[model samples]
Target chain A: MLDLAILGLLFEQEMHGYEIRRRLRDELGLFANISFGSLYPALSRLERSGAVAVTESGGTSSAPLLSTGSLGGERAGLRARRSGATLGTKRSRKVYRITGQGRALFEQLLEGEEPAGADDARSFGLRLAFARHLAPSARLALLERRRAQLTRRLATDLVRASGDRLDVYTRSLVEHSTESTEHDIAWLDRLIDAERQKQAASRTDGARSADSTDPSDPHSGDAMTSSSPTGAS
Target chain B: MLDLAILGLLFEQEMHGYEIRRRLRDELGLFANISFGSLYPALSRLERSGAVAVTESGGTSSAPLLSTGSLGGERAGLRARRSGATLGTKRSRKVYRITGQGRALFEQLLEGEEPAGADDARSFGLRLAFARHLAPSARLALLERRRAQLTRRLATDLVRASGDRLDVYTRSLVEHSTESTEHDIAWLDRLIDAERQKQAASRTDGARSADSTDPSDPHSGDAMTSSSPTGAS
Candidate 1:
């Protein structure tokens, strides 16, 4: 989950560690209390795997000078190169940029089957947050997968509620859980309907435009826009 | 969280490990895929801490025979004691029952201040599942605490949504998250109102019945019932 969040942020822009943490907290509202302990290691892992490249920025400069060395090598070089510089100067910072490998990894992770566990909700949320990068069918599949999971949960909750052993409080908890699951399914239904309509409308437009353009390219302009049903408000 | 769930179940009736695991997965719907790898260790921890007592029951006998040995000692004793018996005899299963310390621990965990993190949702759900054990005041506090948390989350989400850097899909994710948070807060508000009404009704009844009962005894019948608003289906 942390890997997905980190990669998603880097997919947008090159950023230093501090900036990445800030955006994850403020803009994405994820990993709100993520520690530097975990963040730096994830960055290092991605760097080691060649999914991201790290470069060193000068103490006073905003633009990072691209460095070809590894992160450790760059850090040592920076220290040696600046040994005789003025004291009390700011230290260099490492900036990270996603590579082609990272982009492919992000897409793969986003479209992967969700592991059924406690983190299912977070996994789904992260995938939805990056859903625009997905093809139309893939996006719909994501929503449908979530709908199926919640439906299964509702069925279990109903069966539990029908049992005779539950106390008043436990029964209430199950009932409320059932209601919340129902609400989620309804929300997903709306999303799926909107997706189908968008696809249908795009297909109609594609057929009309085919007469003027190449007939071979069917999905000429199928990219999602900001006018998505949920995005409108 | 696992500890609280185990104790809550055992607080009602003595259960073997399999039954406890079953109830947690099917009834609570909280830890759907908890492995015995984690479950047995938790049970052992509870037993070690004197929160629960474990006894061995013969495979053929449904009723567990009371033994005072610790889990390990009992395991060793069982091996030695059953060695002379039939070779095909079923192995004894351990049944766990909450001790006084376990009950105290459960109450403490349920009423403790929630730790803020990704597990906050599961933590709150576990507390609510055992909420009848809490005093009426504590129950209200739980609901109010959840309300406050969701309200804060909604505020952050709205601020993020208003920013322009978000793309179509990221914006939609934020909007959907905001809607869910709003829905959760609204549900909490209804619960809080119902709780207040129940407290008020109980208070009025206490006053009316004060003549026959102890005059100083208030909160006479403030226990929550399954008639809670969300439980009405």
Candidate 2:
């Protein structure tokens, strides 16, 4: 879940790991909490698997100098250099970008079944925060499935409640959850609309990004949005 | 994610591990895939955590035996006697239920953060399936937060695409994702509506059949709903 959330969030925008953590905590409220222990390892694994590439080259030199910790943190620098000090002593903030291969993988993943189990408010929020990677079709499909499932479930619950004495608060609990799901689905539709508008707007530009227009864009370390040398092969 | 998927699907309705596996594959179309290996471990963990319980007393011992794989398997009887055994056997089927505590925790888990990084879709779905156990108010609050976040995000994506000649497909991709998010929010609303009806109906049936009662019904072995008794303290 954490892995999917991370990928989903990044597919929309490039972000540092810390930002990812913050979003997961404050946004989707997913279960299976994401922490440095898990996040860093997962990132490393993704990198190793070629699913992500870090934005380390352009700002590598200035990164180490901006260190907020003790100057004696030379150990950090030394460790960094040890990882292949390809360029001497420059600090680099490792920002990851999803690979086309990763995108295809994500598409396939989204096509699959979703994980189960209900979460508390906080956890679900975190999951949503990161679930931005799915294709619009997949997202809508999942929402529809959920809506149907929830509808049936609520009906069953009502039938069962025919003789029960549940308190108002408890009753509201069910209603609140159902509303939450519905609200989310509606929100997804709006997002789709915005995406369509953007797509239309982009077409008027008449030219692709420098990455597609000029191969030099890839070599230019400063080009954050350049398509990587690798495609979804 | 698979763990949560299994748990959440069960939250919607009780089923055996095999059925859970079948649903994960056949119903949900998850690409990450699940086997009895992962399913059983997740269920075990869930049971230990008090999110799920088994219902054993309902079936008569004299029930006709079927040549089911669960009971015929070596792990059946030994695992049952050691754990709660409830209603499953290689020879018989074990029916698990969700507990109140389990629901609360599932809700809580859903509201927490997911792991960071790309390429974790499998995890994402598993977490989403179980987001039903949270307090109603909290759930709504989380959904609202998600909607706000998506709004901000969709806006950002729009900004990024400005003045760019992004491919029609690429642009479409973003649009697709946005629509899905909108749909999710809408679905949340629907869920809330159905749940309200269910809760309202519950007040009428003060005492109903075990199936009709709240998932917290005591006699149902309640292990499937929450953490096991061992972990309760």
* Interface RMSD of the candidates, in order: 5.9, 11.6
User: What DockQ class does candidate 2 belong to?
Assistant: incorrect
Best by TM-score: 1
What digit string (tens of lDDT, one per residue) describes model 1 on residues B71-172? 557676657657864344466678899998887687667767887776787888888877767667778899999889988877777776698777555576
The segments of candidate 2 whose C-alpha lies over 4 angstroms from its true place after superposition are A1-233, B9-16, B26-37, B47-135, B183-233
lDDT of 2 by residue, A57-115 (tens): 44444554443323676788667677876466444456888888766565445445554
B1-233 per-residue lDDT for model 2 (tens digits): 55556656776778887777765554443432466767778888888888898643223368754433232334555565766523344444566778887766654455555544332333443433333344333344444455565566556555554524443333443455556556555654665565455545645765343222245533232233344323342
TM-score of every candidate: 0.76, 0.38
Interface RMSD of 2: 11.6
| Alpha-carbon runs more than 4 Å astray in model 1 | A35-37, A58-89, A207-233, B59-86, B207-233
Best candidate, DockQ = 1
